[model samples]
Target: MKNNLKKNKEISKEQIKNYFTKSVSNFRNNFIIISLSILKNFRTYVYVILIPIAFLMIYSWYTNAYKGDFKPPELFKYMVIPSFAIIFLVNTTVSEWKNSVFLKRIHSAGISRINFFVSLYIFNFLLGIASFLISVTVMSIISLIYFKPSNGTFFSLLGLLEFNDWVGMLYSLFLCISISVSIGVIISGLINSIALSQSITLIFVLFSIVFSDCFLPIDLLSLSKPLTYMSYFVPHKHSVWVGLISASSQEVSWAFENPERPGRIISFGFNLWIPCVTAFLYSTLLLVSGYFSFGWNTKK
Candidate 1:
């Protein structure tokens, strides 16, 4: 009996190890397949992402130059970075689910749904980072050549060049992209039509931007109780505020409350860690929800 129990234990251990090994192997194979597909149609993806960003950057530059106000960092944080990120992630997510034939082929090949979902998430996230790097690099070059400092303040360009500020910008970018990709995945899973999914994602992002403190101050939230509650849910508000504050040299508090001066309300300062944690939490929730929401049926 003792010998039999020991043998069973050994068998169980081996089975566990084999399960893990198979999972890793499956993930690696799926990743390669996804990567190759992305490469084959790389131009389609690149054009979809780049055009809007280029347009936005050009508009930003023109407006800034006309007004004699060129702040690369603000332009990046406000418009360019998020434009590329949303376009790339949303389009990628929709494309993955739009074709029924592709889904059936993938399913028939014995690729597990979990593996497919993970591969899609990772691919989109990496694409987001790539788009961000490209956009920032291009914008940096433009700034150095075109932007002139009138008052010896190059906060935007400096933020990109400085080590600490650069890291903070990257950190904020990661969180922002993670949130966007997760939301895209969720939208894709829920909406069957590619057009609908893309539209919804765009609208959602636009709505978030409209409500974000970047456009409307959080203090105004007090005017409407419902708006105040809704403000708590907009991740863009947190993301933009965090990105701006992180890049700024000024000492900014994250907390909105002021104990010493109750009348003096702070909008952006709420402890730097709060947005970071909230973004992660929101992404995880969206990912889990998207995975569960994705239909397993391949037949259309």
Candidate 2:
């Protein structure tokens, strides 16, 4: 009896190891497969989306140059990068689901549903980071070539490139992108039609921008107590606040205040780390929700 018990323990240990090993293998294979799909269709993506946005960014900078310095436009700040990242990811996910034939094939091949969702999330998250880097690099080059600070100080662009601040800013951006990607995945997984999914995601992106403090100042929320409380729920508000604060050590009170408009003067006493943590938590929550909510079968 003792010998049999010992043998059972040994078998259990081997089973645990095998389970972990298989999980890792599934994750790796799924990630690689999705990544390869993105690369294979690179040109279609570039022409359809990337190139047009790049030109729009350039034009935005050029127009700003005429007005004063060559700081990136507000559109670039609050919309372009985040919107593009979300759209790209959500589209990719929904497309896969929409392709019934492909979905049936993959299901027949016995791929784990959890692995598929995780791999898709990771692919989009990494791709979002890459897109952010490319956008930053392009803007920096444009600044170098065309931008001239009115005061002959590089402070405008310096905030973006400074190491310590840049690290914080990058973290904030990553959190934002991660949140966006997770939300996209959730939307795509829940919705059945590809076009409908895209439309819903687009509306969500627009709503986030319009309602969030990114375009509208937090001070605007002061007009209504309920609205002010609601603004706290907006993900971009935290991200934008963290990003602006991280970019400069100087009090960012100016960003939230407008003397001409005449509103309540709120103090900038909030800790920067709060938003960073909040955004991360939000992303994790969305990812877990998407994983569970995602359907294994192709039929809605």
Candidate 3:
């Protein structure tokens, strides 16, 4: 009897190990397949790399000519990074929703929902990173040649501590991108009509651009107490703050007031932890909702 019990335990252990191994393998295969499929789209690379670079160049020129500063402008980061992340990712995810053939293949192959969602997220994240590198390189070259920056170092425009600051900035950018990606996935899962998807995407874009406090300060917009507190719900608000904190390489102080815009209270400090925790929670919640809600309900 003891021998039989030991044998049963060993079999259970083996079965659990095999189950995990198969799951890992399946996930890896899904990732590789998704990566290869996305890589085949040359236009994706061009659009992702060029559009932002073009915008950056034009904005850099304006800043250099008018502002007389070649340093990376705050407005550019605020406008571009969030815009790129949302537009690119939302469209990508929506396209997947539109692809009936792909959906059928995934279902027939028995691909798990987690694997599908994660594969999409990771691919988009890596693509965002690629776009970032290309944009930075192009901007760096332009600054080196045309801008004649006063700092004498292109990296300085990104903020202090050179390498460390860049990492922080990238982390903040990735956090923003991650949140955007989650939003995209959730939108794709929930919406079935392409027209509706486009409409919603437009609304998201408009909000991120205008109301995200990108053009005007949130302080100016928030007249009521509820409106003031509600600004925290905007993802872009936190994204911008985190990027600014990372770039400044200075500790955030809530008491510090902007000299240019007086009467407005500062909303700095806890920059790192605030965005990190917020991103994690936002992504987790959205991804969970997306997974449960995903379906082949798109209009043909």
Best by TM-score: 3
Tens digit of per-residue lDDT, candidate 2, span 84-112: 45554655554665555655665577888
Model 1 earns a TM-score of 0.78
Question: What TM-score would every model get versus the actual structure?
Answer: 0.78, 0.79, 0.80
User: Candidates' lDDT values, in order?
Assistant: 0.60, 0.61, 0.61
Candidate 1: regions farther than 4 A off: 42-44, 47-49, 62-84, 87-98, 150-156, 159-167, 213-229, 250-265, 268-270, 297-300
* C-alpha RMSD between model 1 and the true structure: 4.6
Residue 292 miss distance in model 1 (angstroms): 1.5
Instruction: Please write out the lDDT profile of model 3 over residues 86-140, one tens digit for every residue.
Output: 4555555555645567766776788777777777777777777777777677756
- RMSD of each candidate relative to the true structure: 4.6, 4.0, 3.9
Over 1-300, each residue of candidate 1 has an lDDT whose tens digit, in order, gives: 999999999999999999999889988888887777766775645543565456546555644643444343344454424433454455554556455566667788888889888887787678777766566566555555556656233344453445765566567777677777777766776667777767777787767755655433334443555665576687665665556556653344221222235444344344567766776677678778867866544233
